[model samples]
Target: MSEIKKIHMGPAKCAVDLGDGSERGEYVNQDYILNKLGRPHRAVSLMYCYYPLDETWPARARNAFKDKEITFQWDYPYDDYFTYKGGIGGTTDDEPFTCMRDVRRHGQDVILTMTIDPNVTDEHLEQIGKELSTFGRMQLRINHEATGNWFSFTKRATYQQVADFYIHAREVIKKFAPNVQTILCIGGVEHPEKGGEIEMEKEFADAVRATDIWSVDKYMALHWGWPFDVADEGGNSFGRSKVADTYNLTKLSEKRYRELCGGVKKPMVMSEFNADGDVTGPYEQAEMVKEFCDMLKNDKDQGWFNGFTFYQFRDRGRLGLEIEDPNNADCGIEQPVMQTYKEIIHDEYFYPEMKSEGDAQFPVKLRWGGSEDAEGIEIPLHFEKNPTFCEITFEDEDADLNLMMEINGKWFYKAPHAKTIDFMSAFFEKPLESEADMTLKIFAPPASGENVNDGSEDWMLNTYSTITKMPNIRIRFAPILK
Candidate 1:
């Protein structure tokens, strides 16, 4: 047998767009992947169009997704672009904020596609910076695919204006949330004439200074062919360029980013990646994913590539890892690529164990149900040493959900919601000053909007009743300061 190449470098982590963050789609697919498929991706991706007029456009996105379903005047007038100063604080009412917090609580990162108008002001950037400051490390991709014809931002703003907005936004956010990495995402280099005719180097030159990562949203369209006919063309479904190399196009984009940034190296990410299933099938997509992973592992600049977020987990067509079942998104029929991808990601190179630098993460599943659960379940926490600071996180739990925790029968802590509520340090200083073992009485009260008047006494029948529904509940302890 030819010598098997020793796998050296690969993505430190991987993510997937669980699909439709605005609705229950992401939660459904996330549950399916974690509970059914058993994929251990450390991050989740979602998109947001920063339309400030409705005030509830992004906030109440969970209401509906279809354009036709929207009851309010949703579109933001391009010429009358205004600063979105709302949601500065991490309000539980904010869907995106809660989702991001939930992902972080579950020991996963978030990739937010915060599509915005190019006319954002310094004040607006500062507001966003403050909002992001409360969040953990996240990849914030603003105005993705600006060089493409799809996004509205590109149509309204010039190339230079786009670059300027990125530069300013990055500069402002860096002051507050340095952990939030601004990603300069663009289209692939396969067919420059198709949408991105402007030289990327010239286009993104000014923004490079602020960009923490370079990214390209590429699909193996050459091999699979476009799913839809090219718009403005008379039923032309063919790709614009003769070249049909997906891997080469990705490399070319990376090369351009490197050259454009004046040889300064920055981590590259495949922000949105998938192979269309119009021509072949999941097998072709599987091959594409395998080839992409192999390329990253074998490349001379191995670790230079950070990671990739799969285009989707469940969508309308075979474009996703599974064909979405309209009635039940979580119960979609798994595509062949799903199995292949699972095997690939389970490899040591692709799925490295992640740890916080200065924080120790302890995962605990707390489920309350039986009649005995009324008095609350006492869960014991064992720490190697006394933790100076601590934060408890509940995954996807309602914001108004209350959890009562009585520590050692001396200190009592009631968690109002899932957001960061620091109570452990106070308890840590009290009776458990030196003790490493502490007992916590965990119980959930009737949620905020629950119909207590029904008087069924089946209090636990609410959201937090089952472990499967709220799996990833964790307690993170920060290291003592020097």
Candidate 2:
């Protein structure tokens, strides 16, 4: 059992925003898609309003869970259905880009979002990297909620042009979709931690320089435990980590996006959230789904939290898709929050129980992708919810090459190319923790000649960050060419 891998935070990567007040009918209703595959967090989300009709939304997100281990979260529209009726090499009509090429040929994992045009430029981000350069692996989130005030391009893009278009659309997906893992999503509620959130956390740490994960889209209407202080430490519902919302908007934008990731702990996702505990009482959405799953199974913060999606999922017995808006009343599944989220998504702590042994250092801080630019990828490792022995290094120094890291076997090395992204990782000295098995690996090479993207630092590529934001699905290899 002491081979070197064991980590656990149990069950944290959950999702379900199929549709709330469906003006679209929860993607062609099949009982609103089996009430999201009837449970145990199979991950499901979609939204692609490019108009011109035909938003099958990746075949209704592969009809919920037909992809077996599905994990889809897609949202589109920065207005450019391939040049909205003709432009970037005009063509007219629509295709929704072949439904994102049939949602990557029968979807399995995704988290791509968009909505904030500010009349996007840079040649419409090189045609959004030629339409997201062959979606092999994704998690874009393009300029979403930049700093709030609701899009009109958030007051005309200027959070430094919305973090310089999130580092120029992740360097144009490293020249035509280097496996798209770009992220910089903000707006997790009115944001707070000091007036104007310390200058919007210094304009999101001076207009992005690195990213792949740092999401937020908070929500809370009738949350919990903080009536001034009757023993108020967020009032024990399960144990500690209290959660009560109305304005805390996902804990002040996840504590000001971890102070703008200065300490670079990358790997945090609440991508979009929800809460209503029945607007004050009445089974309060099943006690706000058991106090938001017991404050996310007792969060410890800085554990590099990953995925907690739950925006909408059928605002009621649809049966005519109800919508008179009372904050979408208990927002979704209804009736004691759908039987208390089917018994807290079949608890095991939500996902725990993969343990192997002990050492306790654990801080892989969730997965992140590759290519600072030079075209060389093979990203998509795991462990953000479970599995952690923590000790990761990578401050970027060109981030070297030929670095393959299998969960327990395949280990290839060659980082001496000098550049520094820092490395010191741990999840139990060096092996599985809580969760990470399908053999996670990382391999990169391709950047040469003038030493490619020598920006010197800024590499939190945390191996394309995704410590299980769903039922487990990792991908992104197709760059190591020349």
Candidate 3:
């Protein structure tokens, strides 16, 4: 394990919410955490540790991050929802300003998840606006997990009430923190009871309809703590979320969330995901993580998921899927799961360049050409080493391009297969012929009607170009080894 541990000395890579959201400096210790695992946390989420998401004590909180990104989440002392009271913190309203000021000095981005009760006063809303204005470019998720019954805002409020609150929050946050990224988040899907005041699916759908950037808290496990129906009905099962050895991505998935968002098109993240309670030995745990990560990596609707953070870094009671080497004899520095994670963090797709130091980047350059150049879409590709797979993305998906890529001699196809690619992205996993130069040809109906079976080919060719001028392409090389 010591030999395998890799150093994570890059910008924040987002592994958050460890151990009941406390501010104790235990997990924040870098040298100690590095010894236990291969690297330090790219992101650490501290939930409700400070009443106002306090970042005032830089000397104290800064060390925990060790220069990593910070995600601070907490419920405001807003007594907006008054039916059943939870311990609402006092007006630590000034805390965010203090905390964010310290975070800016840390030189990393921050994600702030703030919750307000139903009885939220105008003063409280105004304070939040000021905080965002002060914080600047943070990802602010208001009343996250709005679909769940746990939080005060969501528990008693009707779905309409939650939706209205979310709309208002977004408006307020934007008015102040023009640079802030407002996010809509929900607890994992739930069975919307018949005749219930809240319709989890409809409410979530409505919320995302208001904004494109959304977050969800989902765990891939054998016995899910929540209804499998939410997943089943939504027609989305992100890999092992259907439990071990099952994946039905088409019907229910992150796509369903995307579908609901309607038009706002920012990439989203699985703010909380992992095998939270899946009982597993070391190898099984490794497989679980590997499978799920692979699914996200290869998702045809690739852009829909920008990134994912394991449910937690340390542990919170029985839901403990701590990334750290554990105290139990069954877990150790030799744990296979940790090894898998170390390898995963090394992947460029996950950490990119500035986020991790796992591997040096292979240089890539692109030359521009008119849309009608060459056969289909002219794609030049080369992979000189192992793990040659890459993710191909487009800025527009308005056309039906049965895009096919010819690598070496064989061909690979992207989705929606023969159907239109409604989403703007897809994965390219064509195997490189053992380091030989590789070229990928992505074509809409061939410009030359030579391959056109009928007028449909000519029509399709003309149609794609007209749908949108050749769209922009973005590809991410896989950072991990095969």
Q: Against the true structure, whose lDDT is highest?
A: 1
Q: Report lDDT per candidate.
A: 0.53, 0.41, 0.42
The reply for model 2, stretches above 4 Å from the true place, is 1-126, 131-136, 146-216, 219-269, 272-306, 309-401, 404-482
> 1 or 2, which is superior by lDDT?
1
Task: Give one digit per residue, the lDDT tens place, for model 3 in 188-233.
Answer: 3333233222236665566667764666666665323222223233
Residue-level lDDT of model 2, residues 268-321, one tens digit each, is 666655554323333444565477667766766535455565555554321212
| Predicted structure 3: clash tally | 15
Worst 10 residues of 2 by lDDT: 368-377
| Stretches of candidate 3 exceeding 4 Å from the true structure | 1-43, 49-107, 187-201, 222-253, 261-264, 318-336, 354-482
Q: What TM-score does candidate 3 reach?
A: 0.50
Give one digit per residue, the lDDT tens place, for model 1 in 1-482: 11111111113443333333322134343323553334335467776666543444433332433343322222223211122234433343455665564444333456777777676566667777766654545668888776765455776678778877888878887786665778888764656556433256576766754588888877664222222332233444423221136666766677767766678888777887766554336677677777777776676765456677776777555567777687865567778887777667666666633221221122323332211123234444665555555555555543444554434332222334454444454444243545476544444433331212244443213223222232232444565467
Best by TM-score: 1
Candidate 2 structure lDDT: 0.41
RMSD of 3: 17.6
lDDT of 1 at 222: 28
